[model samples]
Target: MSAAAIESPVPESVLKVEKQNKGTVDALYKGLSDGGDMGKVAKLIASDLEWWFHGPPRCQHMMRMLTGESSHTKFRFEPRCIEVVGDCVIAEGWEGAQVYWVHVWTLKDNVITQFREYFNTWLTVKDISPHGCEIRHENHNHTLWRSHPGDLFKRSLPGLILGI
Candidate 1:
């Protein structure tokens, strides 16, 4: 009924990974759900924080947005898992979320510093900017999710290996 009354956003896929990943998913869930000290979490971030981006939704930007320290944004993330591989965490969540998108986070030194995101491309453009430009491209089409396509686990593996 109310925000506080609502359940946490952690997903089942993540729970499965928590057992093998040294509580990776669980620790992350605690950090995200409780809004704990992310500075300590920075140790998990991979050095080669990567993403498919030219601007905005980059990992640093996303962290700032998530940590509620960014001046540019006014929304907070309520994360839920789509999957996990090694150290890479892939999730579909809300950003104050009016829509769902898959975010893949790479952990290095115990902190998250790099990431890639996939969502309804239409929503991506809409949320980032109403007027699309050369730099801005529509990514999430919903067809993939609707059609049962793509290997999120395989996709996340490269980054996870790189991170570890």
Candidate 2:
């Protein structure tokens, strides 16, 4: 048999753990969608949760809703795809396919310890059993703030120059 065929797949226990982690994240999302409570989510996350964000701070409008800073938050966050690989649960969220956000959750003991947010970027997670991991890319399109901070600045350049 070829080496590819002889290679062993991921263990069943590991797969179960991954599925459980994904389910936890899904419930968190559902809670947020149903306006349940943020305190509950806090419990699911680690006390020292690490959050990483790309693009300008102003474009992080979702933070307002997450932090209870804005009661008029209209945007809804729902995962289009979720993948559990290794010890991480990666969720790709989108609103009507125009805006996208990828949330990477690194969990320890079923509590989220680290979180990474990649706004306006396509995300992919791969499992390389008996090895490491690799990431792939894809094309994405969105509005100014939803696309990139630089794009927002560029769109406002003409107004800035004309002082209008």
Candidate 3:
């Protein structure tokens, strides 16, 4: 027998990758759920990481809109903990108000390297190097403020009167 034992590399990583992938999914989901902090996310994601979703024009557009001198907020499907491989994670889940997004992620040196995402709300990022992260909501609905519809005006009148 040789000094090195024979081993199939892919299977070796399966369990670990799945766990990492689950953690990744959970981290993003917690951020997207709103009412949470984005900084926690920055801490979780490795600097050289990129996330992508290919649905909801808002997925990308909103990200830009919300990004600021302080970019905060994140959104993604509530993924199903499906499979894992060393440095790779696989999951299926919903994105947007009602859509599906499937993804796989690879990590090296505790930093994310490649991300394979499928669906309409897709984004590709590289050299992530997150200094920090923030969390907020993805409001994908008709603007309530634009029309100033009767209901909204009614809702505002009370606040206006109260100077609130």
Give candidate 3 regions above 4 Å deviation: 1-21, 50-76, 95-98, 120-164
Off by over 4 Å in 1: 1-22, 54-61, 66-73, 85-88, 95-97, 106-114, 122-164
Cα lDDT of candidate 3 equals 0.42
Winner on TM-score between 1 and 3 is 3
| Residue-level lDDT tens digits of model 1 in 63-115 | 56444576323333445544444455555554332333456565544455566
Which residues of candidate 2, in runs, are more than 4 Å off? Answer: 2-5, 124-164
The CA lDDT of each predicted structure is 0.43, 0.59, 0.42
Each prediction's RMSD to truth: 16.0, 9.8, 17.6
Pairwise TM-score winner, candidates 1 and 2: 2
Evaluate model 1: give its lDDT. Answer: 0.43
- Pick out the ten consecutive residues of candidate 3 with the lowest summed lDDT: 155-164
Best-performing candidate as measured by lDDT: 2
